[model samples]
Target: MADKGPVAMIDPSQLMRPEPTFNDKPLQAYRDYTIDDTDPIKERVRRTYYEMHSKMTVDLFKEKREKWLKFNHFKATVKDALIRLNEVVDESDPDLDLPNIVHAFQTAERIRHDHPDDDWFHLTGLIHDLGKVMALYGEPQWCVVGDTFALGCKWADAIVYGPESFKNNPDTYNPKYKQVSICTKKKNFVTTTLYGMYKPHCGLDNLLISWSHDEYLYQFLKHNKSTIPEEGLVMIRYHSFYPWHSGGEYRHLTNEKDVETLKHVTEFNKYDLYTKSEKIPDIEALWPYYEKLIEKYIPGVCEW
Candidate 1:
């Protein structure tokens, strides 16, 4: 990853305006899950999480880690792996219905447009969702996509679908787990504020996040000893951990390192989530730049 210091002079005027919130785009129907009952896309998203929440137990996560952490499932270059991921559509996304590759390119391009000097940041956006290839490899969407939360602990009320989504989850019946601290549904409590004001230091490593593509790619990068910096890796790993990054859950599990990582993850989340719109990237034109990026940071065929 590039240094935190500015790599090149950035013209504040040229930076693209922040992506509009869903509430700001009232004219066009965008991913408004509040109306999931009437919106088929949102309904599908809900159903996807229904399965994810119900089945993703600590034991299941451990079982999956045992299988995938070996990094022996397959081997392919970064581009090849991403193209393979193109076949997998995220069932949990209420936004666009494009190929995953398109989403990957969109994210990277948006980051490039905004932060041109930091090629590492651009690469982070490009490869962030490459782990979704698990879905193409026969993993169900329930296990591969959606918001991830910690297992072996109390479920947070602020998670997207709320505790109702975990009704059938085996972990819900466990009595040993209890809520440590929860950021209330306060209006001004954003991700950073949630971490600063309501932050807890229970230790990130001790917490068990729900098995998803985020964890898979994170472990893959670590096992192979890829050079992507810790912040970049955190962006890859926790971009979908909305319950922590967006919902303010699991603040109790974060240590000081997580507090610092949270800033980068929060910044990366804007490009990751808000870039999915009608505009698609010219993959042929963009490929050369990102291909070179892959070579620089995560080159050659890597274990999957």
Candidate 2:
């Protein structure tokens, strides 16, 4: 097997570096969002979310949070939730024919085999795209995985496949996007590259990601900081921040810290995209290893 194995074992650097990619494809990669093929089942879901977002005025956020700020009723163990969440299958797209779990395991396994010494990176292969679970977790397809950006702020032309409504945002009209904002240091918000970053908050817990598995899971992690590392949580957070990966979406927003973080994120993206194959890894074969890996990093059961 070694004879046919990848000649140059994937280094963490190779895995993170920017490359020619179409990772979020057919759904018109790196664009706003995807359609539900008008499938009745999918369409119903689409309509529900559209109505939710449309009616989800800034006021609603306050109302919803005030009511459910302490609600843990919906939360469950990761193992229990993952079993149900894994039911979300997406083979109809032309990309690959594996179940979502297989796709995730495949990404993780490849990284494991490629970067033997970099254990953290191997773990990344496992969790990096797990955020795609937003599809099965009851999130609207549009809000789950689209070009993510600062929701209330002005939109940047650099945001890959950004939403059309952002055009009407007050910040878009502000001088910053077209020119520069006198108040803000980076003109926009993120940095010219993903290399630099700011704490933005005490931790990534305060950052905004598009509403998807990434953000949802980050919520789980943020709430349980004692159980995981800041690094692991960030993996859950930025895996889908496609703007930085595809091009430099939020250049001005990044600070010195984000720059270092972006390097690791960039490395992980390399493995996530290139190692993809149609053949799903035998889950039975991988399960034991992943079970141990999960134990090492995350709580066996997570809030979902």
Candidate with maximal TM-score: 1
lDDT string for model 1 (53-136, tens) is 889887899999898888788888988998886688788887778889898988898889889999999999999998888887
Which 10 consecutive positions of candidate 1 have the poorest summed lDDT?
A: 6-15
Residue-level lDDT for 66 in candidate 1: 93
C-alpha TM-scores of all predictions: 0.83, 0.63
- Candidate 1: RMSD over Cα atoms? 11.1
Per-residue error (Å), model 2, residue 255: 0.7
lDDT (10s digit) by residue, model 2, range 1-304: 3444212211112223456542333222312223444444334433443443343233333443343334353655544444453665542222443456666777777677767876656665666545455566344455454334443333444443233434433433344333223344647654332212233333333434335556656665566442555665665577666555445655555566777677766767656555555665677776777666667766655544
lDDT of each: 0.76, 0.49
Error at 204, model 1, angstroms: 1.8
lDDT of 1 at 52: 88
In model 1, the runs with Cα more than 4 Å from the true position are 1-31, 35-38, 178-200
